[model samples]
Target: MHRRALLAALLCASVPAVALAVPAPPRRVVSLGGSVTEIVYDLGQGGRLVGDDLSSLYPEAATRLPRVGYYRAAPVEGILALRPDLVLASENAGPPQALERLASLGLTVRRVSDAPSVDSLYRRVEQVAEVLGVPQAGETLAARLRAEIDTARAIPAPRHRALLLVNRSGQFQAAGRDTAANALLGLAGQDNALAAQRGYKPLSAEGLAALAPEMIVITSASLQAVGGMAALRASPGVADTPAARAGRIVPMDDLLALGLGPRLALAIRELKKAAQ
Candidate 1:
């Protein structure tokens, strides 16, 4: 072959090999956690989502998608039926057996951490974006989220000691130091009364009294479960607490309040407003 023709032939051969080596981005994705789904939507990759879990209830439109079930108990059959090219899950999104079984199916299952901190949240966003082949979008979202969080944190620290409670049928469970609720309280500049406790635990009348929270944060679902704010205040143990007595109760959406996702900054802002 002529020198120029040989060079062109070599270039064409290399191009085909390079193209064949690159994997196509996942087009049909499944989100196995609420925060995972929220991050995807925030990154403007919602169009690629084919299915999600029960916990993926943000953005309203996510609810319209087919559900594979709750993250922890997600059934392999339901998920495989969706024919997902990729599945993004939270760190705690499965039983060990289920995840092991899933790995055998020759599909990509990415588990992002659910750590309750601003840094971890940003990392999770980046991880999802990388998987979706949109690293730039992820970077933009992370920067915006950081700025919003900083703005919320600029508010003067509240003097009140607050306890976040999850009330289910009048039974109160307090969110402790390691939880997303505690992280939110810290961002809002309120002292978490249950910070000494490691994780969520049921609070007795004595426990509540010792904590002596001046304000109480409750979820909208929990508040409604016990028949609203009035009913929550009237509940035996809660009524005796300073928060209930002083009418210092704040209610927020369950996912937005507890989930460490795109809504985290908003959650902090809402908590700050309610604290004030």
Candidate 2:
């Protein structure tokens, strides 16, 4: 079996059967991840959200809630202050100590895995909804998301090598295999130009030139960091790339590109269009 499939199966089997039978749905909830927050809203339980991590910027109203801090560095005190009956977080959420502290305080903290793939995304939505006592909503949302993603995945593949990168000052950070960006690129029918690598890492001028990607995908935030699209093309090392010459730079909102949330299908479609 595929590694992700094995992990998903193990994750599903590990859930306690009795937990699915919680007597009362949590009325006060704190979300500690962007995708977790989006799933809550998609489940139609946004009103229950009393707080969220800084990453929860989608759906606008989520921004009005008190922030507990960044997902990885959340403070237990801020979360406790929200008086939440339940906390929905990404598995990657936390400095272990803070989450341990929160758990010790007698709070129910449910963690959804952060692995970003169509299967993982479905699992995350289901996990969040189930913990919120809305399993049926989760099922429906997951089904819809799966269908939409399948449709997006059906688009004709563009036979082009594309590199998704983040530029900081003129240096580049490129996405590699097994990352959210790489998964989304495949879903959008573009081959990851940096798939030879395993994760994100700095891309030197020589490295970027060697990759010779036909297209470059970047986030709006990264574009701003290197002085916008025009400046990006003019930057040293990047100026020589075929992608820069062809103006094949695709810039998307960083959140949408990385969140792997409810809007993932939309992101995939947009990227596919850009690649084509």
Candidate 3:
């Protein structure tokens, strides 16, 4: 075969054709991302959700729905068990094989981008709304979100140095650039203390003091893991930081602090308040 033709054939062979199609308004839908689920509820069309991935917990009602598995590693069998007519996945969904299995088996899977940004969030809301057969609601929600985001951005940020941490198995992981936490801090006009690096990294006991952050942020779940504010303040090197010494450690709602979704403006406002 010609070189160009060979390359083209190889590309086609390597990529799977997974098309998403819904002939009518879907009566049963499975949401794979928290942001997607949030948009569905915000669009006032939560009644169509038959099941959700583990990451879809929000709005209180989402927790009560049957869960397939975590969005990032959803199980094919688990998703199949729900008998959904449409599966709306976020950009972070699946172990690749599971999603491919679903698609190859004829499940209509629509993937929405969950990139951390106001524009992306607005697009996500619109995408979810589109998939749910509520384009008007999606447009309205997107416009409202855009206006609220603009209003939030209009407020000058305090520009305080902030450090966000995730506690995993008793170990502290610092949020760096490209993370949801860092994005929120940036939008709120705060500097990410660990922005010198990309993605979450383990911080040494001595590192926090040297960074000298004005505020230390953590998720509510992480706070619970380390036994709350007192425990976090007592952790190694934590007390040495100006934030800890000044009692500036604050834990925010897990989803609100970490997920980019319909409540982004609210999160930004809360982050701004935390810096003060």
Ranking by TM-score: 1, 3, 2
Global lDDT for candidate 3?
0.85
Candidate 3 Cα misplacement greater than 4 A, ranges: 1-22
lDDT of 1 by residue, 1-276 (tens): 599999998898899888888999999999988999999999999999999998787999899999999998989989899998888889889886787777789878889878988788999999999999999999999999999889878876456899988975567899999898898888888889888889899987777777878999888888888888887788766788788777888988888888878988788877777666
Q: Scored by Cα lDDT, where does model 1 land? A: 0.86
Q: Look at candidate 3 and give me any clashing residue pairs.
A: none
* Weakest 10 consecutive residues of candidate 1 by summed lDDT: 151-160
Off by over 4 Å in 1: 1-4, 168-170
| Residues 78-115, model 3: lDDT tens digits | 88999988999888887888888999999999999788
The root-mean-square deviation over C-alpha atoms between each candidate and the true structure, in angstroms, is 1.8, 11.0, 10.1
